[model samples]
Target: MEKKIKPCIDNEQILKQRFLALRDTLDLLSGKWRFCILLNLHYHQKLRFKDFFEVSEGISPKVLTSELATLEAHQLIQKKVEYTPTKDITYYVLTTHAQEIWTVLNTLIEFGLSNRQEVIRSFHSDKN
Candidate 1:
């Protein structure tokens, strides 16, 4: 007789943990500046490090670097080096995954703008 395969309970627990981790990552990237970065990238094709610094006004260099690194690590964006005779320069471009994320971000932006007054009032009321 052939041996029967049992469903792994531990695998389900691991999958749940993975889901929570993914959710936490999304929440972390949903911050103000991070969202701005994504929106800017969606409109712009690719940007050099300096261009990003210039376009994303008021963002500290350290924070921008950190956010870019996080996005790169998540495979949402790609870093490429453009070779030159003098020096190699790196630039950031959105990946396919990043484009998909832009769709979700757009929907979120539309919803937020539509409900801004309500959200603001709720925040103030909750502070009491």
Candidate 2:
């Protein structure tokens, strides 16, 4: 008979803390449009409200406004108002802190691509 080792309390606490952090991160990023909006900002560097509406496709103006407000509140993005002779143009740009998300986003993209391939393979196998 083999004796099983008990889990350490410190390890359990660390795991719990990690899970809580993950939950907090998900809470902040939760929503279809947030990731899309962030990705657009990453690529474009800066964009106006109308630009988001055009690029994000399928997102309503109301929801975009809300999401942008949330991101701004969280300090993930900055809202810049450019005063001009004609009018004030509002542009959204990512904060320096937002750069931290690049690694997470890239990892998610790789995982998604791998998962899609696996799902396609499984579907094909089931058909046969």
Candidate 3:
């Protein structure tokens, strides 16, 4: 038998909680370098520390280290040590979960492109 689907609604408390959580998550992922780091890994498969620094120019070593640690902690990316010996370094690659996030971020990019001026104005206004 086919089951009937009920439309679900969120009450005020749940809505507020969810909104706050979303804001927090976005804040973490939308830092100056986090989004670019994620996109680079997603598109390029993997990158070394210098590769990341080169691709997303102007990111300091300190910021890159912090962002990479945060992304790894969030389970959005993975670090693999390759050729262990001497220089034996690691590369960053996106986890499956990060791919899912990339899809949503692409949608947001499209939306932002369509509203670039409005977004700029809003951002500038918020600073005052």
Worst lDDT 10-window in candidate 2: 4-13
Which sections of candidate 2 miss by over 4 Å?
A: 1-11
Work out the TM-score per prediction.
Answer: 0.69, 0.86, 0.75
Which pairs of residues collide in model 2? none
Q: Candidate 2 overall Cα lDDT vs. reference?
A: 0.94
lDDT of 3 by residue, 1-128 (tens): 99965436446677778889999888878877898898888778999989987789899999999999999999999999888657788888999888889777799888888799888989999999
Model 1: per-residue lDDT, tens digit, 12-92? 788788889889877768766877877777888888888877788888888889999888888888999999999998888
lDDT (C-alpha) at residue 73 in model 3: 94
Q: If ranked by lDDT, best first, what sequence of candidates would result?
A: 2, 3, 1
Per-residue lDDT of model 2, residues 1-128, tens digit only: 99976766658788889889999999999999899999999999999999997889899999999999999999999999999999999999999999999899989999999999999999999999
Better of 2 and 3 by lDDT: 2
> What is the Å distance of residue 41 in model 2 from its true position?
0.8
Please tell me which predicted candidate would have the highest TM-score against the true structure.
2
For all candidates in order, the CA lDDT equals: 0.83, 0.94, 0.87
Query: Which is the better candidate, 1 or 3, if ranked by lDDT?
Result: 3
- Candidate 3, pairs of clashing residues: none
